[model samples]
Target: MSEKRPVMTWLTDMDGVLVREEDAIPGAAEFLRRLTESGCKFLVLTNNSIYTPRDLRARLAESGLDVPEENIWTSALATAQFLSDQRPRGSAYVVGEAGMTTALHEVGYVLTRSRPDYVVLGETRTYSFEAITTAIQLIVNGARFIATNPDSTGPSPAGPLPATGSVAALITRATGVEPYFVGKPNPLMMRNALNRIDAHSETTVMIGDRMDTDVVSGMEAGLRTVLVLTGSTTRDQVERFPYRPTRVVDSVADLVDDIVPPPPTESE
Candidate 1:
């Protein structure tokens, strides 16, 4: 294997790598702290677009993680960035929560139900039949389609509930128009994130817990990928995938020391 360049930036998934079931995973705090102290740019990424970065930062705080709002990135933000680049100040018929709406609004997008430029779908606690019907009708009427992520289901105390991708599928079935997904597993998301931090892919590392979404996306984005066995993907399951991550560790804890800054030189 060729030698890897020194890492200057990091992108990590939220749930599996940092926390599980609303609780902080062991060593996650230290890893974040070390990353901050080392002065490396980082972002805590999540596919869930139901909550804004502030909300997510608060939730992480409740979980004993001190992540800043600016350090949190969601599919909503990625979607907003993508849309802004695609069509500056374009309007969309948005179907999501504050996270989605707020992101679009920040990018000067006007959200309306009447003759929108695009039908933007995102994650929400509740999926309204009326809204979905409107989205379907709008797509049939010639509006473009877009989605925050392709996650089919989301976790809950009750069980797995339908997510953006599931609803997007329903709209697709109704309108025969497939929505573009802009989240993980989509290199567009990674590229946007890299742009956000002004980091180069060759000197950046992506730490994630899922092979299909996180690892594959990072690899496709030209960054080193590290698989943590704390969430969706497991050790034995690694072999099942056609591709592999740059490394696999138990959790983010194993990576804390690797990011610690070097001691000052005697001349200094």
Candidate 2:
């Protein structure tokens, strides 16, 4: 009889769990391979709404990881899906890049400034004052506010750069309207990702480097969570959070043995 795997699906963060600063973490490829051979459904999640799946795949491939486009899940995609479900064929005034805008378009959302139903905010290095002004006015005009993620800063070659959450705060300050954040730390995002792969939370495992967003989200989503110390959070810092991960590892490299191989049948 084969050793039954404990988990049937996996959800992992992109930056710390798999790749960090454009380099694949040790054993990330092997972990992915193991999942492939075991036929477990998985999604590599990212809160950054700047890159599309194809873009992310290319970037990962450069880092020696072979994640398929479909395996990648972005906050932009989640935001678009949420909006589409909330209001089919809705209109929005968007402040984001191609990733966010294209996702919205794919979901049949019309981008307009004239009486839009939503003011959707997403990450972009190129935050335009004109666009921000437009979005603020739109939200004040009874337009619902939505944001891709609440990540305040993103890693960059030159250090931290302002991300969606910071920009969302600026808008909130100007309009007194807080946007509905649609990324990690929100159990809805986890549930939506699980639904995408037809996976049950009880049978899935979530891996990440952050305690607040990754661990908390997974715990709330009712999945086992793992924290790797390869990215943001540290061992000492973990104790600061009341909620904890299912386990903690040095890095993704330490997870190879976590996937128990199948045993041979008696006939064999």
Candidate 3:
């Protein structure tokens, strides 16, 4: 039998694992502090691409978690990188915000208000019929279709609200072409995070709340999976699903305590 691999690095989800909307989940900051002090490398992997890494850092700081910008990775960054590597630099019709647009622009993709080389979708609070029509036109005109993530709803303090996937679905229904996904459950985002951390599947663990995306993606990447009940997923949901995580925890706090001990002694 092959030997089991040990997890040396962690890729964690943001919304439920650490915070619930704008509020920090219980013990989130302390959990992160413990992980950092224990010398374990971790990266905040989020499917939301509405914000850049720096923007997320600021938001996290506001929520009482001091995450460094370099430690944060978003689907926007991954999607932009993927497009830059796969397609030629040209104008792109974006249905997202400044973050998604900014990332693409940084990667040499030009933004166009009309016909474009591609049509990219992400979370947009201002998703209007006009925006959907524009994207459909671009796709109908031969522009490549791509989406940051396929999350149908985004978590909020009250509940979930319409998100990128819903917008992507609209475009799909209108254009009769499905957008290529580039976020959780897809290898692109995971691969980008792994490359950034200089780690591989065997030594990495993907921690998140959703089994369909986070757990499935980690398993596909050959990385360990840890599911937390702090987000969209629940224990009942896990029981009904065929996919399973290597471990389940209440939150990141439990994970940190499990991987890092309090102290060591010389006696033995």
Candidate 4:
């Protein structure tokens, strides 16, 4: 029989794996502590671009988890990095929030108030028709189209709210140009995270609640995938999905149990 592989690194989802809405999931903080103490590298990789790493860290800290800002990676950051490396010197017209704009600026991309080199789309709670029209105009005028993620809707304590994909769809319908996605299901985001940690594909494990984005991306990148039941995906939903994770657990606490070795015996 082939030897079982050991997972050396983890790519985790934030919203569900660590926190749910405004509350932290049970044992998430201790789980992280255990993983860190074990010398296992992990990054909180999320498709949500509404907040920067610092912002996310602060939010997580509010829920009693003190994670470093550098340990967090967002689709917004990945999108900015991809654009900075691929696109020429040009202005970015963002249809998102300050977080998205801040990410682009941090990546050395210029954000323009008028004509732009690209129309970057992301989730805006206050999406306006004027902003949509502006994006369409820019795309029609030969500006590149980019989207942070293709999530149609995001789950919330209240209910599901229209996500960035919905806005991207409207712009696509108007400009007839599909946006290049930098989020999950696209290997770009995961590759960026791996690069950040200086880890290889074989050593990484992706822990997330979504199958289509998280699990598929990890599998495609040749990483082990762990599906948790604390988010959008459920035990029943996995049966319906064609793709399957390498492992399944109820929460991040279970993940800690899977990876951590037991204490040494005194006799030894």
Off by over 4 Å in 3: 1-3, 260-268
Mind giving the per-residue lDDT tens digits that candidate 2 earns over 86-109?
Answer: 999999988999999999999999
Q: How do the residues 38-94 of candidate 1 rate in per-residue lDDT, one tens digit apiece? A: 988899999989899999999999999998998898999999999999999999998
lDDT of 1 at 198: 86
Give the local distance difference test score of model 3: 0.85
lDDT of each: 0.92, 0.90, 0.85, 0.86
Model 1 poorest ten-residue lDDT run = 256-265
TM-score of 4: 0.93
Alpha-carbon shift of residue 138 in model 3 (angstroms): 0.9
What is candidate 4's lDDT per residue for 1-268, written digit by digit as tens? 0144566777898888899998999989988898788877889998888888999899999999988998999999898888888874558999998679888988778888577878899877888888888889989988989999999998876898999998899888888899999999898899999998988888678989889999999988888888999988889889988789988899988867666532443996
Every model's Cα RMSD, please?
2.5, 3.2, 4.1, 3.9
How many clashes in each candidate? 0, 0, 0, 0
Which order, best to worst by TM-score? 1, 2, 4, 3
